[model samples]
Target chain A: MALTGLFLCTFLLVHLIGNLQLFKADGGMAFNVYAVFMTTNPLIKFTSYGLYAIIIFHAFWGLYLVSENKKARPVAYAMVDGKANSQWTSRWMGVLGTIILAFIVMHMAGFWAKYKFGEVPYVQYERNIVDGSMTYGPSAPIESKKEQFVSAETGMEYTIVKDLYTEVAVAFKEWWIVLLYVLAMAAVSFHLVHGFSSAFQTLGVHHSKYNGLIKFVGIWVFGIIVPILFAAMPVYFFIQ
Target chain B: MKITLKVWRQKNTNTSGQFETYKLDHVSEDMSFLEMFDVLNEQLINEGKEPVVFDHDCREGICGMCSMYINGRPHGPKHGVTTCQLHMRSFKDGDIIVVEPWRAAAFPVLKDLSVDRSSFDRIMSAGGFVSVNAGNAQDANNLPIGKEIADEAFMSAACIGCGACVAACKNASAMLFVSAKVSQLALLPQGQPEAKRRAIAMVNQMDAEGFGACTNTGACSAECPKEISLSNIARLNREYLSASFTAQVD
Candidate 1:
């Protein structure tokens, strides 16, 4: 469970870095090309399968831990000072995890499924060449896709990709979508705050000399920085 | 001084339990909490009624036998002291003190405030010892343990196996107790040979004993009579992780 969880943690950082391309001034071309490259790259494609397996493994393993923990305390204390001992996030990891799970479902349904199998709208780009003009369409087959091509009309090379930036902008334009995204990011932040250092602790990588550093990074980096970057997306799009 | 007591009473492990109140008049400020209880019991005996039962030994506080939750805090409001050491002066006249046993699935009420802590014994037996062949004892000088390390180990060794940590924990986790034993040995050279085995075996026993996982709750240390540090638990995590990964390789 620890290994899978940490693996997913690494995945989150990489995913965030790639997704940040959406903020580029280019009309979704950078984000869309990055998305296409991620989906079509053989290595990334294989990693995606592993990612799916790891998520299921991590979630199920967590359920097992939660159930076992529940059974360990068959009867509840009548007067418990829950805040006296631990952080609220540490105590409510299961609930926060469940929230994140729901968020993942909504995310995949809205974005991933649409890109992979659902009928998403397409964009067209026209380029001039010395001899002839060229027209590009996103609705073309995957095998026929090109990063950049020379136009016959002007003999100038132009790069074209899908308009995922526009797609995200359109989605975030709705108040409800922006609100849900922000709320889900909050859940993700809480989950990561407890889970980040906890993963290392569970895996037995802790030491007196460096344990504090691990916790510090977990709190400031994964807990605060990652979630802020993620949450900024919807807010940025909605306002813009 | 006069004080009101709300104490948990149970006939046996299988029977349901409830709070039974008793008022004590002429309670002396100098009397220990248990002595106050003794006063109440003596009064009950004079009245030809069954007295409230609680576990206690070595009232000076070394023994972990005394277990009680006073007003929602384990071992009463006193810091770094057991229930036996809690002085009645800590309470005011007409104060209501609610006493109860350690409430955990692993710890069932055997009577009015005494709990069956034998599950802790089981976890201890699982891996809380070093395997030394019976023979003449080795020279103490030969071990050559560093003083800093020895001090840390002794601090962990001070754990009385009291379930204050478990009681204080929301999850009823025995991580503090088990970690104390594990870290005590893991820090010493004499405990190296079976360190991995001890880590894995003891943790597995802890799981089987129905103790919950540690969620880094600082309550165990805060409420500890011995003030055992939470660093021991971090060491336990490190030990368990190392042992698990290398178990099959061995």
Candidate 2:
């Protein structure tokens, strides 16, 4: 679970970076384009599928362990002391994980689902002939027009290029939404701060000197990058 | 000097605990923190009251038995020292301090300011030992280990099995403790044969003990009386991974 959780944390950095494109000046097209590129790319597609598997496995195993721990200690400790003994994040993994899960679900529903399954109007194009000739004539004028189709059932006009990325920006760029993202990311960072190094230990990869290097990398990858990437999106939009 | 102390008191492991406040007067500044507690206990005995119960042995700080949380910090505001080594001079005459036992699901409190740290012993029992045959002492010159490795092993082995690392961690993780033991042996040739089993058994025991995971916050080392490095935890990780892989391949 720690290994998978740490891996998910690494994925969050890349995911957040791609999500940051929503804050670009170009409404949501830049982010939408980036999203399209990500979803359609074969390598990214494989990684995304892997990410889904990791999340499920991590969450399920984490839940299993938590329940097992709870069962181990049916009663609370008597001393009720030692608040200084452990890291804040270590004690609060379950809470942080739940928050991250909530945010992820909302995120997927708002952007991913919309882009994949939401109905959109098809693009229409028109070409005009010049000088009543099949081919273009000298000094002949040519005309071109574009149109959008509206849904007959819903009576709503929607563009095929509906910027789902723009919708995400509108939702997440709000102060509260951005704050939620930041808070969730902070929890993620804390979770990673411990999870990353601990995963290697649990997996039994101790090597004295190199272990220190791996821990340093864990801090950089999880503690720094995850929060920064998630924070970037809100900052990008809020700055302007 | 007089100081106010709010010490955690609980009837037993099954009962809820609370901070019971007590005051000590004319405590000597030169006296150690435990000495201050001695004064309080003396007063309690004189008053026909049950004195606070806490763990301490080799009050000189060699034994990791002296564990407590003082004023939201381990070892009562002093850095790099055990609870027994903390002196009253670090506080003012009228300071109000809060004292508590190590809080974790794994380390249950036995009574007032005392917790059962046998979980640590269990973890050690799982994988902390070397598999050496029973025989007479070998000649010192028989096995020639380099000075550097020997020194490193000694440093790692210096950990006194104190639960301070667990208390100092926000998650109450025993990573530092487990790492220290694992690294101490893994560094030496004597511990090579059972290194794989040791790593797996120790980690499994740690998990079984319900200790929280390490978060690489470095808090454990900071609060460790011996100042055991966080690098030990890393070494434990590497050892566990390599051992598990080797075991799988075999």
Candidate 3:
């Protein structure tokens, strides 16, 4: 559970940085190209399979731990003052993890599955490679799709890629979609606040010398920064 | 002062339990919680009724014989004190206090508030001791251990085996207690020879005793009467990992 959880946490950081390309003002050129690279890259594609397996294993393993823990205490306390001794997040990890798993399914179906199989609007950018100027072209189907080509008549470079960036914008435009995305990020934030440092403790990395650093990164970076930034993408799209 | 008590009453392990309420008058604020219980039991005797049963000893706190889930928290709402050390003054004059035994599959209730903690005894016997050939008494200064290491070991040694850790845990995990025992010896020089085997043996026995796996919730430490630090648990994990990696298959 600790190893897989930390792996997923690292994946979240890389994913967050990659998705930051959306905020660029270049008409989704940066984000679109980045998406194509992420999907089509041979190395990343293979690693993603392992990432998927780890996620599934972590989720179900967490549930199994919950059941075993439940059996340890066959009877419940008549009234428990759990808040006095511990953080609410630490105790409810199983519940928060379940929510995060559900969110993963919803999120993947909304964007990842859509980009891979659904009808994605295409954008063709015609650029003067020398002068750094650009233009847009009509959306007629090209029988042979090339990532970049030289237009004979215009004597300029043209690049065509699936416009997944626009698909993200369209999906986030709905209030409910934006709300769900924000809520899921909240769950992620809470889950990670307890999870990140806990992984270290379980893996035997805990000590006074490094505990402060672990806690700072756990709460501020993964728990607050990463989730908030991921959440901002949807809100930015909705408001804009 | 007057107070209402809702205490758990059970005949034995085979029978289910129920909450029974009793109203008492003329309670003094200065009386300890157990003294108040004593008064209630005296009242029950006068009325020819079976008095409520609970576990307690050494009334000071060192014995760790007392186990009570008072007002939903083990050892009551007071921090860093056993049930014996808990004063009645912590509650209001009209408070209704509820008390129950430590509930865990490994620690079965013997009666109303007393449980069989022989499982902990079994775990302790599994690896909680050091074996050496009998010889003449060695000088106390022979060890030459550092002060910091000694203090850390002493802190872990303070664990009174009070099963409050088990009672306080949401999962009823005995990791805090098991880890304390492991740290008490693993930090010292004399304990080095058997550290690997001890870690593996104790944890295996702990699992065999039906204790839940630890999830690193700080509840056990927070509720500990001795305030045993959670750092011991981290050290135990380190020791267990190192042991497992270096352990012999033979």
Scored by TM-score, the top model is: 3
Candidate ranking under TM-score, highest first, comes to 3, 1, 2
Q: Candidate 2, which CAPRI tier?
A: incorrect
Which residue pairs in candidate 1 have backbone atoms (N, alpha carbon, C) closer than 3 angstroms, thus clashing? A128-A154, A129-A153, A129-A154, A129-A155, A130-A153, A130-A154, A130-A155, A131-A153, A132-A152, A132-A153
For model 3, how does the per-residue alpha-carbon lDDT over A3-78 read when each residue is reduced to its tens digit?
A: 9999999999999999999998777878888888888889999999999999999999999999999999997779
Residue runs of model 2 more than 4 Å from their true location after superposition:
A9-37, A40-43, A59-97, A121-240, B11-17, B133-144, B248-250
> Residue A78's C-alpha lDDT in candidate 1?
56
Distance from true location, Cα of B39 in model 2, Å: 1.5
Provide chain B TM-scores across all predictions: 0.96, 0.96, 0.96
TM-scores of the first chain across all predictions? 0.90, 0.73, 0.95
Cα distance off (Å), candidate 3, residue A194: 0.6
Where model 1 places Cα greater than 4 Å from the true spot, the runs are A125-147, B1-3, B24-30, B46-48, B88-95, B133-140, B245-250
Q: Candidate 1 chain B: worst 10 consecutive residues by lDDT?
A: B133-142
- Report the C-alpha displacement of residue B141, candidate 2, in angstroms: 6.4
Candidate 3 clashing pairs, residues 3+ apart or interchain: none
iRMSD, per candidate, in listed order: 2.1, 5.0, 0.8
Ranking by DockQ: 3, 1, 2
| Cα lDDT tens digits for candidate 2, A38-151 | 877899999989998888778767777666655444444333333444466666677777777787887677667876777432222211222221211112111211123455
Model 2: per-residue lDDT, tens digit, B1-250? 9899888889999988787899888899999999889899999999999999989989998988888888776786777799899999899989988887877788888998888999988998897987677367679788898998888899999999888787766556789999999999889877988899898999999988888765565678877889898778878878877777786543
Error of 1 at B52 (Å): 2.0
Judged by whole-model lDDT over C-alpha atoms, candidate 1 comes out at 0.84
> Which candidate model has the greater lDDT, 1 or 2?
1
Model 3: runs farther than 4 Å from truth? A141-146, A152-155, B133-137
